[model samples]
Target: MEEKKRSGAARYCTVPSCKNNSVRNEGYSFFSFPKQTDRALIRFTRVNYYLLKWERRNMTLPKVFVDIVAKHPHKVAFYFEDDIWSFQRVDEYSNRVANFFLSEGYQRGDCVALLLESRPEYICLWLGLSKIGVKAALINTNLTGDSLVHSIEVAGSKAVVFGSDFKNALKDIQPKIVNLKKYQFNENIWLSPPLFDDAKDLRTCLKEAAMDAVTEHIAKGNLKDHILYIYTSGTTGLPKAAVITNVRYMVMAVGLNKMVAVQNNDCIYDSLPLYHTAGGIVGTGQALLCGGTVAIRKKFSATNFWKDCVKYRCTIAQYIGETCRYLLAADDKNLVKHNVRAMFGNGLKAQIWKPFAEKFGIKEIFEFYGATESNSNLVNIDSTVGAVGFVPFYARFLYPVSLVQCDEVTGEPLRDVNGRYITCGENEPGVLIGKISTLRAVNQFTGYADKVATEKKILRDVFNEGDMYFNTGDILMYDDFGYFYFKDRTGDTFRWKGENVSTSEIEAVISDIAHLSDAVVYGVEVPGAEGKAGMAAIVDQTRSLDLEQFAEGLRKHLPVYAQPIFIRLMDSVELTGTFKLIKRDLVVEGFNIDIVKDDIFFYDVKTKRFVPLTRELYELIMKGEISCPDNFD
Candidate 1:
């Protein structure tokens, strides 16, 4: 830290005629990483070897704006559609932006909301905020109106910088804000430009930002306080903001980079929507930290995706289960032409995992599990073939994770009088409640002014009196190998014939049939079926699914009763602010064929034309006597 202070005050003298004249300070800025020989860095990077030596100690995250410039200044730091930013230029831009934020009264611990997409601007803002020790509250640009407002308010932002495209959403809450800065750029948001016209054009906006900054000196804060909030896709109630504190789990950057050992020359094609953690935290962050460049995009586009990967020479990439599946559905004469060696991200299903890897010719597939708030993450480096893998922390809790049970009839969690909820044995499905302890380091939620809403998520007196745990609302079923399997989200599980059906597990199969871009599975009400009837809303890939073909496939694959009673062909599935499918809205509408205008599909055991779901068929389907699988067979 003393060395850090002196860094800003260093000076040099110019000699004239063999006489040293005056000294001028060439002060190093926050954006500067101290230069070192290759020898020194090789020695320093050995810190990776003895990291446990520094456990429980404070170490700043190596801001890529600093370290990256020091090592690979001229290498591309970011690339998008047709634009590219060099590490040197990115370092300079982030420095000016940091200085700008500082001049604007932004300081350490101050929350600055970034409403943008996965552009270079997002990276610049992230680096700039970290350099100045300000906390970045990254907002999802997809959110609109109230959902957007609720997120910003929950973050307790000291300032906000809105993108040009989302200016309308910003305008909705400008009056509610105390201090804000409206920044407009070209149409694509979050800094990664589709193309860089010239350095001067890029510099113009940054220079304006620098001039308007409002602080005397930038504050230095602990790494734990740097990032403030990350929003979860609210499929259940409203979307809630999750904090990303440093004190708890160290950012996974170091471990993940080590797992991949990505080369500094690697160009990581990352188009996973900057609002997602994979894009922002894991994608860009991992690449930048390794001195590799990030090839970014606003969102994933199946058509131009691989072309861009080859165009940018992407060596690494990331994906969700569905995105990879989408790619699998594409025409792939050129899929093998790209430089994609390894891919990382979650949600890749077991059934398709092997096929996707083999088809893509991918060398490594890294499957990981984590949430924005949890202290645990399971990283699968061994390509463990088809498991979520294991983290020590997660492995430690698997037994406890399965044992807890909630009421079947009512969703209200049942707790003992002592407040300690019982956990399931190994491999049993149960809700995962994070154990609260003095050592429990986690990013607490950003409450929406309603304490009751906040209180609903907490469980008290677990394991001991006064101990509290946050309800993750996710159910996990563990395998015997310390690998936990993802179960359905709360309310996604339906009971039929006294058996629980995981909507996700079922949809994973339904979605694999080269069918739709999306499949949202939910339980619909049935008159006598004990719990709920399994219904699926599918968005057909061709906009027209052959009912006979789909029914034939479903009947061949699924159990007699497991086949969906009704299949609604929807043009679009409504997603929440966080891009998660909203089943509640789908549930409210139910299976009323007349009430919903979307194309309804029904399988008739006698004459299965995959009939247009009518009121009479829908009524019969809900009566528990309909054997949907018997139609095609």
Candidate 2:
């Protein structure tokens, strides 16, 4: 295959008065092209070869940021609301943060809890911690009380640095985390409480610290050391802190930057929370790696989303499935006014993929698939609609991912008569697992801070004895073209009538209904029922559900067992900071009309209509008196 031509012009040389252009090759630069014609080609080839070798050997998060600072100190590194920080400014700020921590008796390998919103300070602090060999445990700002305490405690954090925005949340968990030292950002030291007596303004500290602190720390840093602890969303239970090493951060930054073809002049608009991997490592880190500017938003507002993009002159934007859905629901006519050429992130459902692209005028939807802790990554670089990623058969050995048959009820990999896990056939949905190897450290699973939680994510003795793999806990399938499609979460798939029911599949179909804003599908338990029954929480914008039209659409598209039996008309569905639906509460409430205040509807098979589920009908269904056509013993 012929190599693709490089995009755009060469970057200006960083060296003063060099009068040479940095040559771009394979998404990275290799110094400036020499003017000597006699040895130009030979010199170019030699330089490129050595740079590639050096990149593979010495690439690390701190090293990359330092290199960018050296190359383009005046370049804008980040834009947060009304503030803009240049590469040199951020580097100096991070140096001060490292110096302050060192003065506080904090040493390498110490874990410091960071509970801050999506701001320039958050990134600076994280980078500073990495420079000094300290790990920053990124806690979700929305978390409170037990959940907050669990995340910090699990990471074994010695200190907690929090912003003023989280004062209430910090107060609520103060008693629980009394043992840990507290420090408040942007606060007057004298006004802070005794517990937070060490509070000092970041800017003040940066101004006072020596300039060489960052340089000395970076030189002593090792790539193998842990730099971050990102907590999971905890959709099932309490969250777990996934360890992120410098090696992992470097891989994520470089891989995403190269895949997206990020350039120095490009500006990336990011609205997702920094605590999430998509916002931090993949979105912001990609820009930092490529010497591009990152536009950070405090929170996602569909009304102001396009305006912000236009204001920031963003060439690329990051999104999740719900972010696109919310934007599509808004009445913003400025959607087509931005310069965004590509939309990058995961969870872009097949139903919304084309409409979102066309409506927003996006040229490419760079959908990718990977969990925070998982080593396996897949990116759809070919612009294939609805495909999370593609891995050719020839590249399967390098990727090392497998779709294995799973037991529907337990959500465990199914074994054959010989006790070996069965690999799924082509086009069949199964749990995706990645082979773990210590030889290739990038492919190894670093797991969570909690040993029990870490062990739960590993599946052993699969295919061969003494072999291990990391369970992704996600169901996926691939087609003849090797394109992978997301099905549902392992826990979200329920067994009914001897068939597996995917909640995501049902939700996708339900989303096609007119005037429906959102839908969250899940399985609910019914007394005397053989398996869980399908239920959905739907947000209808019209305030009137056309049951006849909805029933007809369901009958035409979905199988009998796949259709939701109970429909709870909710005002809105709760979502996490990253835009993932919170289904645990809805699943617990079920279809009980007495407990749930929302209007409930039951599909009446005999009348072929959805009727109000009153107290009388709910009791009858609970008693197993009402017989539904889809329900089978």
Candidate 3:
């Protein structure tokens, strides 16, 4: 392998180990070692080195932002709907935010909940709060009622600052959050006061606040101090607040910047919600840390996705798996030629990988895999179709990530006769884990704010007695070429007909065959069934799903054991802010015709067609009278 000097990327060679001095020497010849190698590890080391530099300089996110502002004061920081915010303007706005909060006697370590959509001000609010050492709990705007209240309560937010658009949501939870100081920001001049008597006019307060730069004395904190509390999607229950320190944020932001080779002039088109890690930190950080301009969107629109990219002259774009599917399914009229050369995000399924790349005219697809709080991160720099990331067999120890055999139902690591966790071999699906090390910030696990919830994600005594690893709660398999592919979520896999059924795999097959953009697969309970039976909820708003064709596709593409026993035709599938499918509701409403208003069908093996799951058929399944297809051969 020849060493290529990429801007913002570290020099790395094909040396088997990092200790090799030959590769470090200048003008050393680089050649392939026949073993698969990953350049991402080199990028990880460079990020680690940068973190060390920040530590030495006593730097934090706010400090770094101020530095960037000083260097590029006139550069456009963000582009919103017909509005461009310069770095100097953002700096001044954040300073006013810090000054106002500081004058209000808000002290260090205090949590302030922020409920706002994706916009330039959203970043400024959190950045300003962090400047004064106040942690901002980035609340999901879509959350309401108990979930909203729980997110705020979990973070112990002393104050809640929200946009006027979300005043109603705040009003609904105001009674529950009695101690919270509410501040409503109306984008337009408020003709009337806030709906609540206690809510203050934040826009007025910010206007009166001073714009003097907040000194280092006020924003004093180590890199380890928590700067933001980003909540989880709350798919199962209430969302858990994940603690993000300055070093952790830098690792996510700068790591991606170097890996994807984002230049200072590069404009990132970010349509994802800012509350999530992908859009909030990684996407926005490109502008703040890398001096690039970010084009923020209120929400993702498949119809307007490419248009915004072309409008902003965006050189880079961001997406998730669902976003890609929607764009692919969108009308060709919405498609347009754009300058987007590189796209980065997770959940780009292999089935649509090539088509998405070709259709969008994107050259590089930086598909990656990792949870919001997990230390085990992987990026597919090679663009191998469907591979989330690659960690060579020889480089596993260096990366400190491994696939260990785990129980599909519990997602717990399985122990051998020697009481040690078993490591999965090549092509064997297992849970991914990253070793928790305190030596480096990149490898350190800065878990959720909930200690018990945090402890649950850490597995102790994995391969050694005292060693610990962060459980990613994801099943993955690696090939001989060191390419790793995502299998399914740990609990998402269920045993059926003495064989394991991967919901992700089944969902992909169903979606591809039905020409549907959205499909969710889960296991449902059946009386006298040894294990949960496969059930699929596919979005078919027009009710145009051809049963005969769908059944024939399933029979040909999927094994009988993996086939969905029940098919649901839903008008729409509910998704999280990041476009992740919400499976809890569908799983809870499992094939119950009375509770579920959507059309349901049963796979009749004899006729090889999905028939209407009426009250008669529902009762037979409940009574364990109907036989499920176990084998077609």
- Please give the distance, in angstroms, between residue 198's alpha carbon in candidate 1 and its true position after superposition: 27
Q: Candidate 1 residues 158-194, lDDT tens each?
A: 6666655666565555566535544444553346543
Clashes (candidate 3): 2
User: Candidate 2, residue 229: CA error in Å?
Assistant: 0.5
CA lDDT, every model vs. true structure: 0.59, 0.73, 0.79
RMSD of each: 17.7, 14.1, 12.3
Clashing pairs in 3: 1-31, 1-32
Candidate 2, lDDT over the whole model: 0.73
Q: Which of candidates 1 and 3 is the stronger one according to TM-score?
A: 3
Model 3 scores worst on lDDT over the 10 consecutive residues at 7-16
Regions of model 3 farther than 4 Å from truth: 1-31, 34-38, 189-195, 233-236, 492-633
Score every model by TM-score: 0.64, 0.71, 0.75
Clash pairs of candidate 2? Answer: none
Give candidate 1's TM-score. 0.64
Worst 10 residues of 1 by lDDT: 10-19
Give the alpha carbon lDDT tens digit for every residue of 544-575 in model 2.
87878998877755657667888888787666
Error of 3 at 558 (Å): 33
